[model samples]
Target: THARAHLPAAGAAAMDVAESPDLQAQLAAAVHALNHASHPSARLAANQWLLGLQRSPHAWALAVSLLASADHPSPSADLLFFAAQMLRRKIQSPDYSLPDNAAQLLDALLVAARRFCLAPPRLLTQICLALAALALRAEGGVDGLFARMPHLPDPALLELLTVLPEEVAQDESGDTGVDSATRCRFARELLMHAPAVLEFLLAQSEKPAAADGVPLHERNHRILRCLLSWVRAGCFSGAPASALAAHPLLTFAFNSLQAFFSFEVAIEVMTELVSQYQELPQAFLSKMPYIREVLLLPALANRSEKIIAGLTSLMCEVGQAAPGLVAEGSNEALSLSDALLRCVAFSSEDWEIAESTLQFWCSLAHCILGIDEQTSKRNATQELFLPVFSSLLDALLFRAQIIDIDEHCTGRVSSIPDGLVQFRLNLEELLVDICLLLGAPAYINKVCLFC
Candidate 1:
């Protein structure tokens, strides 16, 4: 009569009296009080009760029962999310040990997760975190967990893989109650599986969206996020920079930028790709056309400010990633520097997009200054970058000038916006770098002329 069917033997030891018939009634009441209670105090009491249950010896059984109850008509999303969350918390608790019933628990979780494949993503995310935590703490590690993941419905499975790397990396910070030794072991295990993860992601990317009833763009977005997560976890760190540059996932992410729906995530993926793998000459070379295409978007003038800002930010990363290329004045470099200069020339009110390019300019300035006067490339690089920085200096000065509002009110200069003031400070730092490239005395003479 006990709700002990899904409870592992290890977790069952202390559940005899805790699994009474009244347990279900108590749980239902507490859930209702937490969700629909009229009074704040009632909800608080219910929350405290649930927290106590999370730490109870019978918590595993209770959560399993709640998750398995999805077969009943109209199961509560709150219940499913709460159960999944509780499992994750328990697994990450310092006092927790690997339950003898872990495999059984995994099976139960997989089943429960599949039942709610189309559930709210928060619930799916929690379930995935729980599975990830379980995988990290148990015997077989991520390889075994990944081997069993195919049984999940497509969305559920993707969500699981997506969260696995992120959770493992987060646990390495020691916030998950996993000791450093175990964390290091799990990290090693995760690295061994990285290749498999890459292959799996590539395969998933090739699958049509219709196969899983999820939209193609949505599926690809998830794949992009998974790629980003893996990159952040250093899964690809061991790969040669050229191989990473040519990776199919990175190519897919680049292609994703062409779409309206996937544009934001695609920018993020590309930005991370270039920023982290700056040494990828092959990758940057291959991506030149795409980079050029983004800057020349015919409808760019019609796009929203946020989209333009995102594009500008991505270009800034591109500029910093290959400052050498920019100094070499390759057509690609010139095109990129042109785009950045245009961003700097944006209306004074739109200072943020302008502000974003300051670092890129400063970087170009340093790249130019670092050139040896004895080298033949030195003068050529200065000639290439001179106009670019000069145009930027002019733009910064224009941005700094306070509006007089009217010639009649010339002495009463309008108050400079705080954003512009901060932007000017940033401009000063870049000005120093620029002055280093073009003699400081020349810069002072130019300023004196403006005065």
Candidate 2:
């Protein structure tokens, strides 16, 4: 009867095995081969066989066996990750129903998750994502899933985040932690746990440790990555998200942007915040004073070229978003426009950097000159707009076709004259548009300069 109970559904059309005993034996063999196969090729074949059973009702049965194998004293990140993924996918199917042993199944996963913190980043990320699939499942069924026996989501999930694989801290140094979209997707899943996860972050930020010798700033940096993930994914809603906004102790996120040699992470966090401020302009622009403070940090003067370019472009975006913030005398005294002009003036030799810097200048120039505004001209002054127009004129100088190398070249070519012409066209158009905004006199000067 045990064999009969495991048979394919009676209504399973053409593929219903006429015999239940044969199918059950195959299932047993597949599980055994996967567990004891001595050779790598044999193991690969067994893994494939189990994967193939994914279309059958018994796929959940196969998943349980595979997940069990993941616990061997010497574990395989590959096997453990794939098995968890398979189980997660199995539970996701609309036709698949949870078995009587649902609690037991989740308990196994919880045990695996507890130990995955020591795994490599790729494997660790995958497992956390898999558990996330379970905790935040089937939409409206979340409450039911949450009520099941086991630990609170806060501690369980916080442990996963606390050990954050070290790679994420290197974000500003050119390390890509994970695909941004994937990170955001999992982040949303984590946020579905809400106030619990937020509580964990709040607790850490309150009394952080030099645990394992990790610096306090670096720890907050990783925590902010988790926090910002929700922001980027637009999951910054609900009580927990509101609590984060109101947390006085975590004010460092916005304030860290000015720290000397020690705050690259904070600079990056606030930069992202400013860059993504278009989401809630009112909320973000209100912090313009602090944003301006970040823009004027003296440390930027001595930083590397990459830092110079990133911060310069970011500050420029801040100016574009809140032009009034940079319009001289409008803010009463200091304005971000001075810092923006400095960024453009120093980076004039690098076209990419110069272009980004100038683009911001052009935005403000258009604002001041009333090029596209349907209403009356802004109350902008010559002193306010002088740096903008001057910087654009400097950009125009880069477009001058010095020699037209395509004409004299007899051998291999470098950026054919057509390519160079197109390149110059953008700068020429930028200068022309700016001059046009500044009116006829500036336009005539531009044409004469090109000549």
What is the clash count for each candidate, in the order shown?
0, 0
TM value for model 1? 0.87
lDDT of 2 by residue, 69-91 (tens): 53335435455555566676655
- Work out the TM-score per prediction: 0.87, 0.62
Per-residue lDDT of 145 in model 1: 81
lDDT of 1 by residue, 127-198 (tens): 888888888778886777877776788788888878877765664465646666776787777778788878
Candidate 1 ranges beyond 4 A from true positions: 1-21, 171-176, 294-299, 348-350, 374-376, 401-416, 440-451
List of clashing residue pairs for candidate 2: none
Q: What overall lDDT, based on C-alpha atoms, would model 2 receive against the true structure?
A: 0.52
**Candidate with best TM-score:** 1
Backbone steric clashes in candidate 2, count: 0
Residue 104 error, candidate 1, Å: 1.7
Which residue ranges in model 2 land beyond 4 Å of their true spot? 1-50, 53-72, 91-104, 139-141, 144-196, 210-218, 233-250, 255-303, 328-335, 345-352, 357-359, 371-382, 399-413, 416-433, 443-451
